[model samples]
Target: MSSKIQVLVQPGTIIIIQNNNYKVRLNMIYGKVRVLRNSHRAFKCIPWLLILFASTSTYAAFTDSLTVGNAKALGLGHAVTADPPGIDSIHFNPAGLTRLKGRQMHIKGVYGLFETNYDLGGYGEYQQGLIDELLEYQYPGSNGVIPPEAEAYFYDEALNSKSSVEGPTVMLPGGMIDIPFAGGVMGGASYSPPGSNMTFATNVYAPMMSGYNRAEDDPGRFFQERGAFTLLTYFSPSVGIEISDELQVGFALNFSYAGMGLELPAREPHLLLWQYGHPWFQDNFCNDDGTPTGTPDLNLCHIVSPYISYGDLRIEADQALVMSYNFGLLWSPEPWITFGLSYNSAVKNDLDGDWEFPIDPFFNQVLLDNMNGSLWPSFQALTGALGLPLPGVAETEAQGKGGKVNVQYELPQHASAGISIQITPKWKYNFDVKWTEWSVFSDIQINFDRDIAFLMLGSIADKLLYRGQNGIEPNGVRYQLNLQDVTYWGMGTEYQYNDKLAFRLGYENRPSAVPSETPNAFIPINDGILYSVGIAYEFESENTLDFSIGYMNSKSHYPPCSADLGNGCNPNNVAYGPYQGQDLRSEVSFLLFEVLYSRYF
Candidate 1:
């Protein structure tokens, strides 16, 4: 019997015993105790979780809705579909720009302020407790009696989570040069600042069961940390020509540069298992018998443990480049009526960057040892195959250091139409509608060069599974995002109180693109209604100064939560209060000031 056992163990057994004691201990202590408790708990609550996740994930919101050029439209509630003569007229109606009368140059600057508050409450906590009780039942308490405190800890860790307020300022600066030539020929170049903003906040929490621990109960804990920040910018230079007195055509070359920076503090919880906590816990918590846990505290300090590495994790993306083109047409057969159409081609982005990680040395060793001596080389090989830089170094240095190809992103196309009508000389009105084809923004593909790393990371197997789960195509591409065509309706009227001064009032209604099934932290979908009023002053010459102020109001409706869950703050669970499915309102007010100095050459 001894000889037979020795033969079965072999050299591999010895290595496994020596290098990975945690797995050995786990197997020895609870191997036969059933590891499916966590899975079971997940299954029990999936229906409700799916419902909430789906509803929130479906809609996409506009962090910044104001277009790049044209103060007139900006001031007129973005309702300048028909009112013309500013550099941004190309965005509304290129024909209006053609009627500029003479060669001119315009410069404008705008300061924007944004504020948002979220009110969320739900049943995530109660579900967490149920999962804990299940886990405790399957595993059995060490003392034969389950402690009520343990159950409370589980609930505390599962729900009662809050996020800090995040407000970022946006800057928009633009300039346009217009040239008027023979036969109504007007050519020009326009430059608008790329849309850019940053969001940063810190969260602190009390002790609770960690999603990483899978522990039925744990003492109070604390976690303090910061979130993510990203910046995006775009540049477009265009030229327009008039074919006849009533017909005008235009084309634009668009260029864009995007950069992202992510700095997550070191003291946050480590969702990975083995060294400290398990990765599964990051999204879930369970009991000894594998029951679902309720709302768990997500405060940063409460989640961290002494056994884990507390090193800051930073991911700074390299500058990504994309190019596209725009075409537009304007026709005015009658003096009082004008029509326009425009299309923007899809933009493809080839992103390459590194993810900087100062991971725990011990865990790194554990992972390396498991790889059978080929981790680093395999990682390098995969990076080369994907045209991506290593995950930490700058783009240039990453090319030299070598890494694996991780992911990719693509932009969508857009189409728009506008109409302007003159009702008497003093009163005029305009309308505009636009659509973006965002469904084409399908998948984010991650490629691996090394067979071992690829397999261990579940790149090949999990990729297939992920695709299937998200309705991805055969090429490992998933189009789970259900973004719909966007619609915008605007109406504005101008009252010319004599030729020197004019007052404008406009209103706009813009629908969100996000569907109702997959809401997440990134997209805040709210149908926005805008009210605007502006006054334009023209001096003796062709110079003008336009000042406009606008206000926007929006609201979102969510589901209900369970009674056991504290407040319905859990985005994953249902709401219990009378406010379930009721609207969560948000408000925004803006001020637009523009000075347009036009010089006829």
Candidate 2:
């Protein structure tokens, strides 16, 4: 037996061990696993790949995920790892803080628009076709119409969209905050005692903020009706030291608050559900399985459809402290060019929260009244012997807990390297390449302290319908994202128009980190282009003001039944809930503006 554990590092790439001493590659698509004689070669290739990432494309910023909160960094498309911005250097590059002298303060403000639109399609087409075909085979006259239950499940209700008009959610040390008009407020300061080689600074800001509210009538509500995720580095203390004139290094520790809230209606739109919805299924299997003792006409699968929601789930999770750190190095080998590198440690947020999963009243009643037979002996007990309240008897009042719920979430590691080049006295440009370990999201698991109505449903239809292949275990559930590690390039330029004013231009090509196979509107932004411009004004008293504006746009297209594993585009497994058939296309755009005031005292 091979001692090596199979770890999935990248998509389509896996390392396998055999013969106790050999490593090989596993080809999952083939019947047998493929092996290489020189498995050590795979280990040797890792370093080379990182070196090659200098020119590839990676993940998105802003509303997509990691948002560069510094106005200067935003203006430069976040290529400022080599030329970090003022006090915000505590995040971009700690070493850059060493460049600050005397006492300084920077107050910043930001406003942005996050917009998303989706083209919903063939909601119940796939499942309906199956129903019709089955009906035709069983009874030709039944082929004329779509069932009422099917419409309820796949209703093309009012579509929802996100706009800048809504408020923004912010997580702070004390509590969650809400701001008006898609904007944020923050400030930071730094100090370097006279003739000292070290500089110290502190800043509070949100590195990543995501959330939105939509109408309840939206059919897409099944996937994401409303949700918010905020990571606020409320307390960050950092220091930088000048080891020498040519070399500088710095490190910082951050204490943050993370909060996530989501309200999603749940449903099963899998193709298998359509099979059970057939009349033949109910006629043959809906009654009592043992002989002659006939029972009521218990309808089991009639109410089950790809379009009908079974329940609604709302989660509120927060972590008091999310600990993380950053390290950076700056080396100036030449007068015109400087090389910088920085690393951000990964963080795991074990959040504490509560959850409620309430089954729909009508759907609840359907099950309470009609479910019967040996196929569901356990359910029979709940409706009869065990004495569950009558269907729709205000099930909303139910709350039984074994313990508090917790969600384990990860913030992946980040490594960035860049160079600042002074082409001439007035023209300077910066280029950076970054790698983010987004693959940590290959699977995101949720653990529950108590059993809920939604989790309870998985036991009955584990494989053929919904609740994943094995159904969600009563104690835990997992969602597989299968994300990939991303490597991307960013660049920016600053032209000193004169001593008092400078013009900046930046461009970054951010590729989607989420696998194409699982792409959907819930996450929204996809492969995109970021374009930005900014200006800096210097006063006679050495005070400076900077302002910038940037925009990012992305879109994706998924055809019917094209995704592997019957998820996302396939609409066959309800992997993304309501994102079934209609040539799904998603467009997301971000328009943002920022202002920063830096004063030297």
Candidate 3:
């Protein structure tokens, strides 16, 4: 018999080939793997040769820790902790409602706007053909030496172009309505309740809305192929009591709901490298001394394929939903001087929903070609003689069901303090500071109803050992994430030109919670500063109309590898496998707008 071993393959079936040269096994549906036996008959196998691999919302951490929800809040840089009082105060500090007289109602509309872009340098190119050509020439042939023309072509035409990804403007809308009832005797009767100044209020609003979608060809696809979005809304009923003219306390019952959608690349970069960069494959192409020859082995280039290209594939979760509380205090020692504080409790959001995984065309074609190639004729003839089932190549659909997916994330709790001072008769100055326990946002857990053992050979072997048998061990895929804490501060001033008009200006700063060593392309955030302006017009009816606008242009953070930061940047610190050396250069900006209407009844 020829030195080469013959083999037959079947869809969704396994075949064992035992020969003097090597023992090869096939697993049709999950992924591809080949096994070889040594002299001692001990099989050397790389686990999970091939399996389903994809990414989903691994980095949707605590970006929502702080938000400017209303016009007065935005205009004042959300520093309302101690200064002016409005319906939006219910969010900043419910106790502030004690300052309102008579029955009152407040309505406000808010929008979070974003426009962003990123470039990882390797956009719009695939390294597969280049890798294949390099590997083929490593076979001690003249072609093994890449010609100067070929080397030039690889850098000039293949790598020199810009493939930046830009997203259109995205707008997230939310609104709040509040009704506060000031408690006192309805008529001018002599009877006075001890706690007559108590006020009860209820408000409903969307607290946070975040989403982004990237092109499939984007190089960062290995980390976040597409993107994700989340929207959270809450209904709060509260009571505020003015114990005396100088002090007030507030309590609110918080009921919240969250919905999320996410999509990611199919195969994680590391997994692809694990499957293709086996030591055996490396030894075959490199020189006997393990040093690169003058021609250099091209198979080494296979390592880069998983890093630079996304293969235009995706897996997505359609929806997931969860529920969480907030407490407030406001103290006014004098008419011009005030202090405020608030604490929001942490909440865990568990999102469960449908998911989708699209099959990769390149992987499918490769599997088909291997099964139907030149060796199939002899392999089929032998299997037929041995009365084995005829081998057939199974065609995978472009996509498959991703069963129910459940992912859990923690929304961090935040505490804030503020002070407001009337510097002059017409100018009111405010200062606020906030801190979030983002440490609690450490990790995200992703679990699926179905066992993803189909991707790992170890799980497959265990499944086979107990298939149709009782007492089988269970195995599934799980992923996690870790994050850090953040701080924010704001300063604002409101000028009352007259009873009919008021002007507002403020500034705030928030720093990134993501560590540089653990950078994620999805969250792509940094130190941010927001400059805001607003105006309030009082109608003859004594009702007020307010509008505010906020603009934020964040500083760019180029990984040390990209910026020549004194601290040397190692691609492996940020990414794994082939994607390790890729540097990320990102710029992010935001625009916030709000409108509020208040009426005293």
Candidate 4:
């Protein structure tokens, strides 16, 4: 009789199978199992194996803790209204620049350290054929479960994984030479890190199969790491005119440059058993007499060699240059009251660069020869699955890799309004509202030559549709984007005890650019309360120094994860996951230190 039997076992039950020539053993829990024998081999049925073995996890979303405004002045919650001092005043209220008592030159420098600790984990089933077919369609030139690409795309999607820990010690040493001419002229330059550092890790594991639960103390695994960095510098020149003692007007030209680099270390292990149709079994076949079987089944046996590769992809763009202009007005309506307004034009950046993706000479010769051509569409689709829009492509065009992709980024226009009042000789109050048109950042595009391999992936056509829907006209054969917008509200207070010492405090709340419904790990929507404190000391001379610190305790209440069916018969009765029930907390702290030196000319 055929040795086919289905049995339901309770959790923690050890089942033993025996045949005339063979024996097998397994631990079963809360499920039905089927055992079958054909010729001399046996197979067991474990339906939810993928769900049991898969890993589900979470990580912090990507959010910049560093605000673009002056880090020093920002530390005080921007409450420096009653007494506007130096060039740093442009950050708080450009109108405040009118309060400069004399022609002066000011220079300032800053340094900072940032860190984050992340703890995340989860379990989810793998849809065997779906992911494979999707990958094959997306990356046509790749073969048999491209583990590197798989892990890259998986983590990119699951983790929306960007770096949480960005250690940046930046210098904003700009010397503003202010002159009292028609109005006034001030020019200076500053340097800072534009975005969070990019650090990533990829892990892959083989699927479990019959007889060989492959369930040893530890299963096989592979890991890879990649790191990227960027530096940004800006130059500004401005002119202000004093219309009256109480009102002043000013204008400034803005220019900036950005540089970026990336490094990736790729590694993978060859598996002897995984290549063959039977993966979970031991490699060496032995006879009952404990002797090696000279004639091994070559069809069911193979060898995998350890392989490592490093790829350095570098791109430099002189086109990283950006330029804009700002206008400002300040008014002192009464002895105790002052108001300021500033408008900053958008800075447009069309970054053109030479890009080189150099493959490793040792282990990637095959990839080098075969992987030439356009892979952007596949890369875009992979990134899309992770909820991040690719750099220069629209959501629709993301599926097609063929087109002119240009690397571009834009800084939006901004409007600021602020008011300061001296309620008492020792106490001052301030309020400011700023609007940033971040929505103008719509999309980034990368232009590339049309390679047939890339064209076959439907990259160009998808992008064309996306452009049409967005009402974007293709320029120089490239696509466009429409990013989200942002608004900020701020309030601050200053208490003075003496001529040399003062205490400052402030608060700011900004809404998230991305809505909670489409929360992606790539860009986190951070809406939080910022608390700040700072101390300013003035020397007997014409110089001063300031120190400040701030903290942000943020929380996001995301909808629960999908329900687990095992605990209930119907969808409504399904067991809900832990992360699904409530809020996820994320915390960030900013320690800012700066020194400013001023001298009248």
Candidate 5:
């Protein structure tokens, strides 16, 4: 649904437009309204009693998925690959810059509100031991073990509840930059010599940006507690040339700064430790006096709880410079129809930063309590006497990283094709289809400056429920992202209400790059739909203003124990294996408002 309102001031004009599949905005800007006795008069008087104020126009969310654009492109649901927006065309379709007659400038600001909500449900039936062990921890018996806070965490609160992401934030080189309303500003300019067949332009913009913070105990934190990722295209120089009467070609070199930081604790509630509770173990293995274990001071039959975490992995990395390129061509066969094709190159980034992975005390206590003294020495001697390939492996200590690190990430390449048709003298239609090569993220590799503790003990843990890396090399870890390539499209229509005003409406279907077999709270998005409305007014022959507002939403649901099916809950996942038996329902939504002003001289 779409509606437009206009309020005339003594010296200037004010207008408001509405509609998105989600989110709501009112009728008018500041003005006066009179009591109306008729429907016509009622709508006409809306401005008298209301006021609406919106600011600069631009778009930036998610990272490098082409979710960023100016007001005009967004208004048309980014179907403008064929009819790019003024100076900003340096990014969308550089060939379009050749259409500008003289020196022109475009300024845009964006107000972006992004929110994610998740519902967590109980674990599966196979995970009963997890509850029993936690119960013992909450209320110890003969053994005077310290009572942990697991009671409230599992039963009273936290689990099987709802949680949401906190307010948004953006990270740049200078550090955190926050605006009044989770917004950002960007601009561009272009110039062409008199009667020349070429144009040059530059712009500053974010290809995609998103970040979130959650309460330490928030259920959603099970996946990741806090993180931020952004790619800012601070410099892009472009050139467009009119090759012939009907063809235009262009190219642009984009240089950007990207930062990615994350912190998450790892938890694994596998079924490996439940064998100690079996009746057979106690009935047959215990001596008449009770307590008969093989190794001195070691209790191999002691029950081990699976509710706790190994420790937290905190990483903060940034790439100072990332480079990519964009090239596009525009063709006009008839006066009323135009065709466009564009390609964006992929960029690989090697980031350097600091990382720390501290092992939980519980991980150390298990080894310390049973093998406290010469028992550890005897185990080391036994392994050495056996001529084991991993000499004295049982004597090796657990480890973690707390130093410099390097990681590899790639921004996928994508291509788009668009068509624009002039239906009637006052109507126009545009459609575009795009493809993104997201499969480049199948595996993410991280290298620590030195051998981390976890890798040293990786072999033993891999024998349990985890699948180890093919080759456990020193100072390295690998996680499988397994993202899928995707294709999506959008359509838009415009009505020219005389030469001074135009109305535009658009819709786009965006699908997730993450596959269903590997979804978790971290990548909550599935498939999404975007709804948009806007008004383009040429207040003067040489100046134009574009206002656009949009809403986007995506939802996903995962059943308990999905991991049992082809390792759905892969341990190599950045989120770890905590999601194995928990049901999750997630929704991610965005509300956007933008204002773009372009002036020509």
Candidate 6:
């Protein structure tokens, strides 16, 4: 009997035990698990090993929909409902699989380029001038200008500082393939199986790849920075069956994985000082002591505020996985006309992962500091005199914790219909209408497995009526996107010049799901008009190459407003207060290119 065991560790770390008794223990960090053992029961630990490996895989950011697709469909702005004839049909209208006559294979790849610009000077003008003035006046000596030390303290003490304020370019890749077994026809004494003329297919596509990195000093940092990736890729396996010569149907199962991360300001600086009874801020004309004074000090009254300094609370979920499905049908009642419909089910995901956040060293040591080394000692002596322990002040340390954080997100369900008409022997036209149920994405909630370090900040607000000014109760940390349902319209034309050459062109109007009043810096998406063109060339028998490109441009602006949460833009009603009343404008565009090779044998 052989008793040698092999163990693989992450980061290329490995352990091998020839004949030693070892017990294994596993610990989790950054969504990865590490196994430590000292018992030789390797056979019994195999299942545990599998679980550990599975738990280590993590995913991030995902949205309601993807904008890129296969070259042919994308060339038609994805309006292939009634003209589906290849692997792309698996997603558009799988029933079109019956259009294939022989052995079929297709390999496709797509690349996407994205750009976003935000005119956030309105938000920055307030915070930047405040900070500069604070440094020059209170901590002076830079000749009436912001000192280099002040600038360095705000920008140099964080992650992704350089790109935190701007959106970055993103790349997306996608492909699909189908295999069919030419089973005989059904009925008429043949009595063939249900799917005798069926085809099987698989696809991998990145439908949503969008995010940004905002500079730490960006006034919007209190709202969001190091923006969440919201990136999602779908793996689908499907089957298409011809119910009859004139009608066909298909079904597909979709498995989606997402990688997500987000960072935002967690506490108010002014509130922190007030809660700790700091001397720099006098409350109700009283000094650090509770005694009321007739002459209230005004010199240092305006120095401390939520906008003075910054602290970050970041959340990350990797390899978050979920499942959904799609069904499609196509029918041709006449020789020159075809109709198609497809429905994609909603996907619900509960992201389980870890979170890391350290108190801001700059905020703690500078803005909230009492400006005296003995302040803590003095508070401790006073509390001890009253027979009570001193209250805890904000301590600076990275609170890295490993546990399941539930991020409940749902991809909206969609339904679309399309018609294709053969106007001439060489010319064909197509049109489509689609609807998305985006109301499911009304808001996003982040639930931690254990009490987060910043919960106390919100709890203090509720206890001290700090949130009363905003006219809301503390619900902890969350975001209110308040999105709306959207509809899309598309049109395309294809010209079959000859058996060896073909041309295609298309246009589509896709509206934004989020309202302008609730604009978000994380996703710079807007109502876009897509223009596309493509060509196909057949150089050999039943073999062809298809290439195409599409471009979309859109813009969105959020002016200052006052209204209820569900009706209009109201930042005070949301968790991140710093973004309130700040005018935000964005210009966004997307360019997609694809190439596909298909062969029939």
- Candidate 1 per-residue lDDT, tens place, 331-406, comes to 8889898787876676565544444435445433334333333344576478557543222212212222333333
lDDT ranking, high to low: 5, 2, 6, 3, 1, 4
Q: Please report the candidate that would top lDDT against the real structure.
A: 5
Candidate 5 lDDT, 427-448, residue by residue in tens: 9999999988877754456677
TM-scores for every candidate against the unseen true structure:
0.58, 0.78, 0.66, 0.55, 0.77, 0.66
Residues 32-120 of candidate 6 have per-residue lDDT tens digits of 00000001111111111111111110112122223334678867767788888476565677676666644445555555565545554
Better of 1 and 4 by TM-score: 1
TM-score of 3: 0.66
lDDT tens readout by residue for model 3, 1-601: 2232223323222333333444435221110000000000000122112123323332333344233256777788778877535544455676776766555555555554555545554421223333445545543354445455444322322122222323321111111111121000000001112447876554544444344444555544444434433333334556677888888877666554454444444332333343364445555655666443443422242322332232332233322234446678878778889888987777777756555555455554444444555665576477547433233353123224456666566777878999999989999999999887766655544455653323223233323443412111122332233346767799899999998999999898876665565444435446678889999999998888888988876545444233211111232221222232334455666676667777754
Regions of candidate 1 where Cα sits further than 4 Å from its true position:
1-69, 81-85, 120-128, 131-162, 169-235, 263-314, 318-321, 357-407, 446-480, 560-601
lDDT of 6 at 47: 14
Q: Runs in model 2 with CA error above 4 Å? A: 1-66, 123-128, 134-179, 281-305, 369-403, 453-472, 517-521, 563-576
List the global CA lDDT of all models. Answer: 0.37, 0.59, 0.48, 0.37, 0.60, 0.49
Query: Which model is ahead, 3 or 4, in terms of TM-score?
Result: 3
Residue-pair clashes per candidate: 80, 4, 3, 24, 12, 30
Candidate 6 wrongly placed segments (more than 4 Å): 1-68, 122-195, 214-235, 263-309, 319-321, 365-404, 459-480, 516-523, 560-583
Name the lDDT value of residue 43 in candidate 6.
13
Question: Ten-residue segment with the worst summed lDDT in candidate 5?
Answer: 32-41
TM-score of 4: 0.55
Better structure of 1 and 3 per TM-score: 3
lDDT of 4 at 235: 40
